[model samples]
Target chain A: MIDWALVARTLPEYWVGLRVSLLLLFVSCATAFLVSIPLAMARVSRHAWLSWPVWAFTYVVRGTPLLVQLFMVYFGLAQFEVVRESAAWPMLRSAWFCAWLTFAINSTAYTTEIFAGALKNTPNGELEAARSLGLSATQVYRRILWPGALRRALPQYGNEVVMMMHATAIASTVTLVELTRVARDVYYNYLAPVEAFGVVATFYFALTYAMVGAFKLVEKRYLRHLAPRETGPAAGRPT
Target chain B: MLKKLALAAVALAAFMVQADAQQTRLRVGVEGNYPPFSQISPSGQISGFDIDIANAVCAELKMECQLVQQEFDGMIPALAARRFDIIVASLTITPARLERVDFSAPYYDVPSQFVARNGAFQSHSPDALRGKRIIVLRNSPRAAWLQQNYPQNELHLANRETDVYLELVAGRGDIAFGSSVVSTEQFLKRPEGAGYGRVGEPVRLQGGTGGVGIAVRKGDTETLAKVNQALAAIRSNGVYRQIMARYFDYDISPSN
Candidate 1:
């Protein structure tokens, strides 16, 4: 049986936690988007020197669990004497900074791989057309490759965003009061697991759908060219 | 093959029932990270004051004690869900917790204290530490106290008792607030805790008695009575004292 009264009392705390989770999600995703563009380009490079390092970066980050990566950054780095006394200790001491840094870097690894895959799938004809049109290498990437590959990567990138949102729950381990921590605190205080965790589950469910719906609209707009054309009588009809 | 597998399943079920009938198994929940009270040794054995007391109580009650290690924050919920019958993890008896779980007679009482780097500040007053981060274990009596009293100070709630001091040593917090015994024995006496010492007087809030008790699910009077009886038997038979001496030079038996 769910306790409605307990849920009402804790709803405000969950809202505050939601705001924190949202901030962490958006900031990390935005940063990963910017950083991954270059890393992903490097990943698909012809030069082994550039490609291998990017490959190694993605391999190392994507290979390990995100929780372990977070712990190493948040707790492990603090173990070193030089790190504690360093000029950057001010920022490193902050749980917010450490969590955001870890999430963004983790997101970058996965996003880089996704974008790189999309880049590899670029139609050879499109590249040849851009080259024959006398477009420079920079112009080719900016005008043709990036736009088309980003459209291809949109669906997978949306998944990464949602995953990143869920991953923010681990922020509670570093002392950030995100949604999971709020639920846990409620559960701790009331011993009402149903009301505590159930409410958080509902919040996550709603957020996930909202994100999925938004991505659907974006996909509809950007990937319209790829959508199947109207068939039979509808193909010849004028609106 | 199907007939042989069915026979093996029946035999396994019968053996499990027989094993269950052999002894009254009691699952005891503990936070293995709280040093001096409960901690896992380098060899992975759970040993400390709380563990010894739990084992002695089991011996007194003639029950088989099985330790279930869990994080301190989840202890009460796990108890309510029957993940364990009782908790012996140095859980302080406070009014907030009493509403959800019933606690046995006090086994030990210790004061809370603040530990900061030597020469950080002498006072633990809110005015002195305003805007400074103070680290305490999440869901703890100290955290509750700081939230209510030190409204101006920033509170950093660590997931484990050990992490309270770890955060302080890592310069993540300006002060560490926790069990005086743990701060003294587990932190100040250790090499990493060098240059850090108690900076204020002891605090006993909530019920103000600071009794640490073995907890059972609310309305579980049967287990509560058994735990209380076992505690009394161990105290009278010197088992409690023997365990106490191993962890502390000072007396910790609750003063009634």
Candidate 2:
């Protein structure tokens, strides 16, 4: 049922689309990672004043559909004359920039919640022990809280990154020409959904597996102390 | 379990046959977003030039017409899948589309034109638009034409024709190119579009046939012929002109 010949002939176009999808995935992932760190910290703050706005940001972003949010950024913002005449119009007008901003803000909300939850779950004994060792509040956070919480958040964050990769498909609606958009164009031109979407499915599957594999390696490195103690020498062998 | 599966398959085949036997109703597909061609009213009725033309064609063919709203991109696929008998979606007759479905004779034609802020350009020439951002509907003939002829211009593709105009108005694109009917009726007539005007003359691209027609499944010659006859009847009996006058003052029929 697979059209291997067509897949071969159209590989280059798919490759270009793959590059776009990956660019969106990596850039948005990096932006989310950086933004979520501070947002998560603020979310777990002792003061409500520090945390409420972040709460509201995550609440609204997580509550709405990503497509709606994308549209709001892409089309809704342009409805304002002030936005059209703003200094940022040059960047805001580019579909790629709008898509990146939407995805970054979206993933940051979800990732911030994940990191905050993990931070809250950090062992209280560790914080007490750090404090007892004469470590300042900033030193405790820098040396103990952030690292431990991050390690705990790794698996969930990995899943979030993969979800973000899939979510990038929606960027096509804004005409960014990512993987899903390329598949759609191919389907439109060739009238062969089987071959077109099949290729897309394969690419996504491989990328997801690669992401999962990388996360497994990172988890092994960072969460090793959390693993069950091995009794035999051979038990140390990599799975 | 095996017997039940076989029974289910047989039942599906019977239903398919029943569906095929019911030919009294002409199921028409329309994209309700394309203004002046087809649009959904606030009350949810599909009405526009394409819808009216489809209604006239159905009257001539003596079939009850049912309008099904579909996205423009999915209209042909929906027809091939038998979701509808014909598409009256202002779909341009193009060689790429002909490979998948058959189209009746042209019912109307509207040249593609570029719209930009007033005084953005004196002419729509490659030199004038060089290095300027241009927006067009994705997968459209205008997009293909821009990519081929004005490769120097920065091209942006928008999924919706409305978004192309939005990009232009927002200063993302220097010009927006799309159907003249849509540009004039949907955008140019709107208050927000007051600052914009059609730039240069309507662009007639080579191999970009602007003819809009009723689309049917490939090899469906009987329905194709009936649609063509109905189209010709409407045009000759002045029904076409009457309908055209309601929506547009100028002639939109194919130039040839």
Candidate 3:
């Protein structure tokens, strides 16, 4: 029922698709980390004006599907005369830039959720310890709190990272020629559904496995320190 | 328990029988985003000349047609995937595409045209386009044409026909290349289209008049002949002309 020959023939094209996909994953994940740090801080801020808007933004973006958000950005926003005239139109006009921006924003929303929770669970004792040593508010956050929360966030952040790797497939809908799009082209050309889609599934499997593998290296590298302490309630007891 | 299993089998058999009897259910593909030739209404139903022609052809064959929307770039691939049985999309029959699939005799023709911002000068080859930003669909025949001939022109491939026009209007590119069908329907019809204009005379160059045709997977002789018969019926019965007038301001060369 599946066309393995078609899969074999389209391997090179799918490889090209894989590169774009991997690039999108790397760029979006990296940018999401940058964007999420600020958004998570604002979201978990003490002031309602700061936290409330960030919370609402996360809620609405999370509520809507990525497809609809991409459509709104790629198609809906282009309908306005001013957006078409803006200096950013050259970059925004490109499907690659649009796909990159959408994925970055979407992943940032999810990563913010992970980082926000980690920020809350930051060791208050560490902050008091830094304060007892005459560390300023900034110094406590920079030296003591940020590193602890970041290490705590690693495992959950790993999950969000894998989610973004799969989400890159949706980039094809806007015309980015990524993995799934290439397979669909092969599928249509050969009229072999089994072969075309099987190839796509295989690529996706390898890609996601590689991503999780890479994350494993990152996890073991930085997390080697956190591992000996992570056992039970004692880890979260904050002192 | 055996009787219950037997009953379930019979029901499944009956369902399959009904589905086979519904062969008259036609599935036609079109780029509903491309107007006049094919376009989708706000309610999400496909309409315009190509849609009407597909319905009439299906009626002549005594089949109930279902319209499916596909992007211009994906139309051929989608049709080949058997997502639908026939492509009523304004697809041009090209030598490269023909290698992979079968096509019915062309139903209509649209000339390929190059368009640029109002102030730009016209040159036929890439030497003039050299260092100039030119827009075309990636991997389409026209893009290939430019790559081979005017390789010097910087190519900016866009996904949709409107994207070409939008970017050109924004001065993002020096020129945009596409079918006359898209240029006439979207750009020339709009008031603000004054900023953009077609270059050179609309000559039959490069890919020729670009004949539009229906396509299916190769070797489906039964499907191919049946579609031909229905298309022949539409042309003879004047239904094709009726559908044509409903959409186009002028008649395209169907005799080709």
**lDDT by residue for model 3 over B147-221, one digit each (tens)?**
777777778766566777765665557788887777877887788577677887654546543577888788877
Clashes of each: 0, 0, 2
Per-candidate TM vs. native?
A: 0.86, 0.88, 0.75
- Quote the true-contact fraction of every model: 0.63, 0.60, 0.10
Q: What is the lDDT of residue A173 in candidate 2?
A: 93
- For residues A1-239, could you state the per-residue lDDT of candidate 3 as single tens digits? 45566566678998899899989989999998999888998988999999998899889889999888887777667777899888888788777898889988888888898889988997778777888999987787788777877888888898888888888888877768898888766654454556777778877888778878887898898778757655677765768
CA-based DockQ, model 3? 0.16
Cα lDDT tens digits for candidate 2, B96-190: 78988899988888888989989879998888887888889887788888889998887877877777787777667778998887889879999
Measured on C-alpha atoms, candidate 1 has an lDDT of 0.90
Docking class of 2: medium
Better model by TM-score: candidate 1 vs candidate 2: 2
Once all C-alphas are superposed, what RMSD does model 2 give against the true structure? 5.0
Report residue A28 deviation for candidate 2 (angstroms). Answer: 1.7
The alpha-carbon lDDT assigned to residue A236 of candidate 1 equals 68
Task: Flag regions of model 2 displaced more than 4 Å.
Answer: A1-4, A232-239, B1-25
| Highest-scoring model, TM-score | 2
